[model samples]
Target: MSVFPIRFLTLAVIAFHSNSFAASGQEQQLFLLIRQLDTLDTLVQSTPRFEAPESNARYRFDYPRLTQDIQHIRQGVKDYLSPSRAQPRDPNELVGDYRLDAAHAEPWP
Candidate 1:
C-alpha cells in the first residue's frame, strides 16, 4: 500500500486538533463524543450480508459495548446541553454552549 493515505490522515488529524477548530474544552470534548457516537451509530446500522448462506451461519456481536455506547452518547448530549457543570439547565435551550460554526463540527462516519 502507498504511504500517502496514512500520512494524509495523520496531517488531517493534526490540523483539526488545533484550538481554532474548537471553542473551549467542553466544546472539544462534545465534538469528540458526538463524532464517536455518530461513527458507532453508523457502524451499528450497517450489517454484513452474504449472497449465499452457510449450513451454520453465526456471527458475534458486542451487545454490551453497543448498549454502553448508546448510554454514553445520551449522557454526553445531556452534558453538552447543560449550561452549568453541576446540573442541567433549561430543556428548551438544549444547545447552550454548542458552537453553530461548521469549523467546530466534527465529521460523522
Candidate 2:
C-alpha cells in the first residue's frame, strides 16, 4: 500500500472526471441547437402560405430574423466547441525581432 500508487490513481481519476465534464457541456450545447432547429422547422410548417402582398411582405420580414437567430446559434456552438482567441497570434510563434543583413548577401551562398 505505497503512497505513490495512491497519488497516481487520484490524479488519473481527476483527469478523467475533468474530461467527462467538458464533454457533457459540449453535448448539452449540441442538444440545444438541435432543439432550436426543430422548433424552427415546426414554425415554418405551421405558418400560412401567403399570396397577398401584405402577407408576403410580413413573411419576408420574418425571414431575416429567423436567419439571424440560426446564425447566432451556430456561432455560439462554434465558440463553445472551439473558443475564440483573445489575441490573433500564437504565443509559441512569437520570436524576438532579428533582421537579416542583406548588404553582404550572396545568391544561394
Candidate 3:
C-alpha cells in the first residue's frame, strides 16, 4: 500500500473530528441558554402576587401566561436540538404579550 493513501485518510479523519467539535461548541451555547430559560421560569413562578387597591390601571403583568410562554420556548429549543424526525410545525405562535387588562370585580355588599 502507498503511503499517500494513508496520509490522505488520516487528514480526512482529523478534519471530520474538528468539524464535529465546532458543532458541539454551538450546541453547548444553546444548552446554556436553555438553562437560563429554566432559571427565568423559576423566578417567574416565585414572583410575589399582589392586587392593586381599587386602581384604574388598564394593563397588568400576566405572570402565569408569561411562565407558560417561557416553557414553550424552552421546549421548542429542546426539540430543535434533538428532533426525532421531520415533524409538522406548530401553527400556534407565541403570545408574547405579558401585559393584560386587569380584571375588575364588584365590591361585596
Top candidate when judged by lDDT against the true structure: 3
**lDDT tens per residue, model 3, 33-101:** 577676666665555555453466776666667667667767776887899999657777778665666
- lDDT tens digits by residue: candidate 2, 4-99: 322433343344335444567756646555465556544544444432233223222233233344455445555555667653432332122222
| lDDT-best of 1 and 2 | 1
> Which has the higher TM-score value, candidate number 1 or candidate number 2?
1
Return the clash pairs for model 3, or none.
none
| Cα deviation of 102, candidate 1, in Å | 44
What clash count goes with each model? Answer: 0, 0, 0
Angstrom error of the Cα, residue 9, model 2: value is: 45
The C-alpha stretches of model 2 lying farther than 4 A from their native spots are 1-26, 31-35, 38-61, 87-109
- Those runs of model 1 whose alpha carbons end farther than 4 Å from true positions after fitting are 1-23, 49-59, 64-68, 80-85, 88-109
In candidate 3, which residue ranges exceed 4 Å CA deviation?
1-22, 51-56, 104-109
- Report the CA-based lDDT of candidate 2 relative to the real structure: 0.41
The worst-scoring run of ten residues by lDDT in candidate 1 lies at: 93-102
Better of 1 and 3 by lDDT: 3
TM-score of 3: 0.65
Give the range where candidate 2 is weakest over 10 consecutive residues by summed lDDT.
92-101
Listed per candidate, the RMSD to the true structure in angstroms reads: 14.5, 24.7, 18.3
